[model samples]
Target chain A: MHLLAAELNPLGHVMDRNIIGGPDALLMGDPHGTPIVTMHMLTLLLATGLLLWIMNLAAKAITTGPSSEGNDRYLTRGRMAQLIEVITLYLRDTVVKPVLGEKTNKYLPYLLTLFFFVLMNNLLGLVPLLDLQHIVGAFLGDSHFAVIGGTATGNLAVTGGLALIAFLVIQVHGLRELGLAGWAHHLLGGAPWYLAPIMVPVELLGMFIKPAALAIRLFANMMAGHTLMATLALFGLMALSGMESWIAGLGISVIAGAFAVAITFLELFVAFLQAFIFMFLTAVFIGQLSPHDHEHEHAAETAHA
Target chain B: MHILAAEGNPVAVQLLPLVTTVVVFGIAFFILSKNVWPRITKGLDDRDNKIRDEIKAAEESREQARAAQAEYESSLKEARQEAAEMISKAKNDAKAAADDLRQRNEQELADLKQRAQRDIQTAKQQAVTELHSEATALAASIAGKILQREISVQDQQRLVEESLRELQPLK
Candidate 1:
């Protein structure tokens, strides 16, 4: 039981790398000793860098190319550009616009950035960069190269930061669309004035709860997938280290590898799905604050156009 | 190997990543909204309008062409109708002219026959008178030879009148 708990919980490895200022207690002889910059942070930078490069390419293609149909225009220039367009257009026309109604165009930039950022971060997490880095490090005497792999989205700080921005956007949009008085009054549901006290406090808590949910949902999903993968992998390692029978180890590894493969595919799907869910929720919340009349007029205009 | 490296708390809200994420997101939002979306939207809008207008114009021209074809067909039918009318009118006029010419030709032939008959009758009377005079003169001369005498002008005239009465049956 002790051995199983140690292997499954794996708290020791966590403690060793969790150090802020001290040298890495295990494995790596990184000249910096302590990793001031953690693995998750590097992965976050990688996702951001990729987003910037891809978006910049898409932006340039849009601005310079002549306006025409086919693969020449800004959105249609390349397969990747077209893919970006498909996602953005689907979210805007199908998901975002119909909800936000009048202020859709105003809030579009923030929404697109959120969707792509989250999606990129999620996708980056799916790559076995960390596993590969670890394997290579094991071969190369646990060098600094192994530090390159981590699921940035799996980290709480990263998701929390994303949720904070989403929360701000939702609140700011409400305030901007409806003035201070209107915004304050929104918390007091449509009940009688006497109910304002209870409803306001409840609604305020609801507001904070929404973003927190977003953060936890993303963090938990990523963490769960990573944990499951690690646990299954640990079984194969245990069979090799604990058992004298090499054949048992080989059989265990084969089973573990197959299950891991299946989970990896599931994780990939979750990455895309979660990003979409986060963006979708944000858009829906923003839509709730606006007036119905504006929505009706916007729908009419859209229908006519 | 640890799947996740715990850093001073893997779950802690680190300042470095949070700030970096925020800044990166901010820059992305600004560039995309300002630089990318506007141009793409404009191109899409312009292309949509242009295609629609061109389609409308093409449809209008096609309708006009159809109208022109109908008009030409109608005019062609009218011209054929007029030509048929003209050809029939000319045929009627030609038939009427042929009838008139036949009538005039018949009248001229009848007048020529009448003039020739009058000339024959005059020639016949003059010849008959000449023959009668000659005969009477010859008879008078013979008689004169036998009787040794010539016939007088009153007697010749009487003979000519007698010969004209005899030729009336033949006329």
Candidate 2:
């Protein structure tokens, strides 16, 4: 039981680790050494690569010209490509367009990339690749090797990076559209100069708070979901190893496995929902600083013309 | 209990993964913006334009058809009105011609009746003159036979005239 406890620590499955040579090495832990390449980094690259490949295929399928015989050019070709097109169009038309208005086209690429990347990472986390890698490492008598396994979005560093990018986009766009004076005026929270003393700091804090919330929300949701599934899986492992009666262990394993399956499905839904929320909130923040009335009037005039 | 304890490294924000995620995300955005998004957006725009044009064309054709139908209906109404006028004129002309023919025929019949009446009067007068001469000659012959001699011209004329005067009162 003691040996099993050491071998099957559930935290090890959910936590980030240095794949190459670092403090969190699976075989020999290096407490002082800084990680050059971690598991989450590898997962992030994989997700990016997968995103590029999938989007490339979708673009090709969507952009292909009509056949000589029929008007099939308008139709998105494959199921997967069609699904990607649907999601892209939905986010553009429904979520981003109404909020961003004319700027939707300019910013759509970044938002779309963010959504698909986060979603890919979230879904990759749900796969049992990490467990399979560990099982393979154990079989090979080398417990230190991990090629690609872990939730990149679940990590604080990764989610913080995404949120930081969102923050930069929002502020940069705000500055560009509002100029220097207009941007400073926005810090007043639409209040008179007398209220600037209070509103400035509050508005500044709100700016940082918004991105921080985004990072923490995505990170906590993903991490908690993975951790819950890991915990449920740990119960099954404990039932197998810690119990004296094999029948009781088997029964508990079944129950824990059932619960784990249910959580896995929930995590799948969370994966999509979290990605959507991140993109949607980023758009909303950007919309707040944009010249709403001017752009709307321009659009209305153009439509009239 | 073991799960709660930080057996391995505690979860914290690190530098490598953060930088890596930013780089990866930037690369994905750059590549996708250059290659994928523009094409997809263009496709959508093209499809929208095509649909709009098609709808406009359909509406135009509908309008043209409606105009043609109206024109055809109006011309049909004109032809029907023209035919009705012609029929009424033809009926009036036929009635006038028939009245003229009937008046001419009635006038010719009256003229024929008058002529026949004149001819009958002339024939009656001739027949009465001839009979009177024949009756005078027979009376003269009977008187001569009774006197056993031919009567003189003057005596016959006087005797005839006297007989005609007596017959006039009987006629």
Candidate 3:
């Protein structure tokens, strides 16, 4: 079974050196050194930019007025109203308040933007015209390469960059809340001076652990979903290659297509959920540094104790 | 010669994944601190203000509703009390008026009865006086006829005895 698996699929090693190869765009001398402007990055950016433009237009159309039906501006159109209501409620209940608490009000706007931007980018990765490809003259067409870019967050470089930003924000807020002396004291687990040697390294490690985990979580979810779909697609291609029975090939192809579609829907939900989770976790981490968070620190204290 | 130099070589050389990680994380940190974080925070403040305003407005509306309800109840209670007072006042006025009428009528009836009784008593005395005067005049005329002139004491005594016998028969 292992030999058959290897023979049936040559690209079994999913995490290849392709990641370290910088982006193909850079390789082709596109001169756009935007860190990871690879195929996935390009598609992700385009999708996100397009989604943002659409959201902007929707936002502009929202004027304060009474409609012909005597309904308020917020309820003027069913679809637009429904979309706005869902986003607003999700941000307020799920993202902002849970992390920021009463001061959630203070951070709501930033978190909402973060949620939308990440969500839009993740969702765009799941699109089709955004991703179909063709072959041309002994080589896969350049257009095909352009279309084949998959999930953005699936790339370690991208998710790591985002996590790094969150890390900076958490530290900045922590220092701001504690000032220099208090911030130093907090690092020592808010413990006695004698325990400083042990707690300092632990706190330093704790700092990196949070952001590292964030990067991994986002990267893993996006990468795993895309890889599963691609593998299923390869199964159908393999059947076609091995057999003269067109019916069997067609049946495998249909099954592969169905699997891709089901996975795409799941990926879409994960895209939104992960973005929300990242933003929410960022808020929660920052909120820990707030003046009112002594109780949470107390738990950390007991653990250290 | 320069084209030949570029020939037979891959166009792109790959950077180490570690180097890529550093470069990406560095750029993201710079951009976030300088541009993204500020814009996001501004948007956040706006959203915060909006939520707070909504919450405050809701609380104020709820308080106003409570106050209005209290006022309405008080006014309703006052109106009911006023109605009860008015009814009681109406009853009292009616009773007072009835008592005044009854007392006036009773006083008038008593005065009328006294006047009527006095008139009846005076009328009876006047009738008795008139009967007495008439009877006296008749008796005097009869006595003058019975007693003829130029008679002595014996004749007067005989006449008095005759008068007595006639009076007895009449009684």
Candidate No. with top DockQ: 2
User: Per-residue lDDT tens digits of candidate 1, residues A66-138?
Assistant: 5364434423567786677667668878888777877888887788788888889888877778567657876
Tens digit per residue, CA lDDT, model 3, B61-88: 9999999999999999999999999999
lDDT of 2 by residue, B1-171 (tens): 654464454457888888998899999889989998998887777777878998999999999999999999999999999999999999998998999889888988888998899999888777777777788788888999999986888888899999888766534
Candidate 2 is scored at a TM of 0.78
Ranking by lDDT: 2, 1, 3
TM-score of B chain for each model? 0.70, 0.58, 0.54
Enumerate the candidates' DockQ scores in order: 0.32, 0.42, 0.06
Model 1 residue A89 distance off true place after TM-score fit, in angstroms: 2.3
Task: Indicate the residue-level lDDT of A208 in model 2.
Answer: 94
Can you tell me the DockQ of model 2?
0.42
| Native-referenced Cα lDDT, model 2 | 0.83
Lowest lDDT sum, 10 consecutive residues, model 2 chain A, at A296-305
What TM-score against the true chain A does chain A of each candidate get?
A: 0.81, 0.90, 0.77
TM per candidate comes to 0.78, 0.78, 0.62
> Can you write out model 2's per-residue Cα lDDT over A74-106, one digit (the tens) per residue?
777799988887888899999899888899988
User: Candidate 1, which segments miss by more than 4 Å at Cα?
Assistant: A1-36, A59-64, A67-77, A143-145, A293-305, B1-10, B39-152
